[model samples]
Target: PGAVLDLSKVIQSFPGVLPKPSFGYAIAMRGGAPNENRYFIDGISIPTVSHFSIQGASGGAVSLVNLDHIQGMDLITGAFPTEVDDALSGVLLLEGRNGRKDRWGLRATQGGTDYGITFEGPIGENTTAVVS
Candidate 1:
């Protein structure tokens, strides 16, 4: 409904995930508290995925991860494997994409509360880089 495409809003559309009754984007999964969930990017644990997150909480008004850079996402609710630690409610895994090696590219985006520019290209013989 707005210019900003929030990740939290998208997550709210999933079944068994409910948005917090109050402000911000904190979510409860399978009747569990929001803080019981965990977030990860490229197998690395991330404390919070939202901007202006609370001291021990995991959500805010906006997401810190850019959707354009994300290649895939996995949402696991309950019965987590050994690799996912401290997840009593759910786990959100974000997989990032590598930059294009064939050529350089640039993109600019304007949102409701922020603006961003992304650049991607080859950094080395076989390595690529993406900066936003």
Candidate 2:
């Protein structure tokens, strides 16, 4: 992969994040179990959101969501809101970008075993559509 964006690469390098190093990449954060953590996108919970999900808690080798479409993320390690009651370890929240209405935009990226293109623009005066 060339110029690929991987969340696991970043997480694996973090302090106190122990590595699994078996097939897939997984991390034990601050001595907590990997399964204790929770990951979310746009308020929706998913079974697995990574290409190497069975291996690493670092978000696998490839993220299921497109990096270019992410607007922001909320990572809470402790004392999360009551609504996020499932995790005693941590929360990784993601927000996706809304399509731009003013003008068309396109982006592409390739890395490791992943590559993709994204397109965004107005579908109508009051709506926008984003495709990846």
Candidate 3:
């Protein structure tokens, strides 16, 4: 898996993040612990951003988020902001894509497990609905 895309490889490219040889995609950042880093989508915290091997929790190979679904990424390091006081090393914030509002849409995700179908449309005049 050394041929991952630039977006998936960007997190380890930061100045203080060190890439380990045997930890899959795991990184030790800012001379801190490997599990010290945190990940968030929108404003909700997730267990990890890396793809799992299905039966175990040891991740770090490839990321779970598709590059096509990302709008932006914020990698915060140092300065210990008061809002996010849990992390000791850094934080990775990911903004997911918001599907088109002009019309209904369907997206398909394949691999790792069974096929996943997502349907999105407007539930009301100002509210959008999505089901997966």
State which candidate has the highest TM-score. Answer: 1
Report the lDDT tens digits of candidate 3 across residue range 1-132: 232433336677778877655545666668776578777888888766666422223236666666545679888878755767898877888887666677898887654422456677776677776654
lDDT of 1 by residue, 1-132 (tens): 442756777678888898886557888888898888888989999877788866555588677777777789988887787998679998998898999999999988766655667899998789999886
Clash pairs of candidate 3? 25-60
| Residue pair clashes in candidate 2 | 1-111, 1-112, 25-56, 26-56, 26-57
lDDT of 2 by residue, 1-132 (tens): 232565555445656556666555565666787767777878887644467666335446566666777788776777887888887666778788899989889989875657778999998799998887
Error of 2 at 106 (Å): 2.9
Q: After superposition, how far is residue 23 of candidate 1 from its true place, in Å?
A: 2.4
lDDT for model 3 comes to: 0.65
lDDT, model 1: 0.80
Please tell me which model should have the higher TM-score, number 1 or number 2: 1
Q: Which residue ranges in model 1 land beyond 4 Å of their true spot?
A: 1-3
> How does model 2 fare in lDDT?
0.69
TM-scores, all candidates, are: 0.88, 0.78, 0.71
Clashes of 3: 1
- For model 2 the local lDDT of residue 96 reads 81
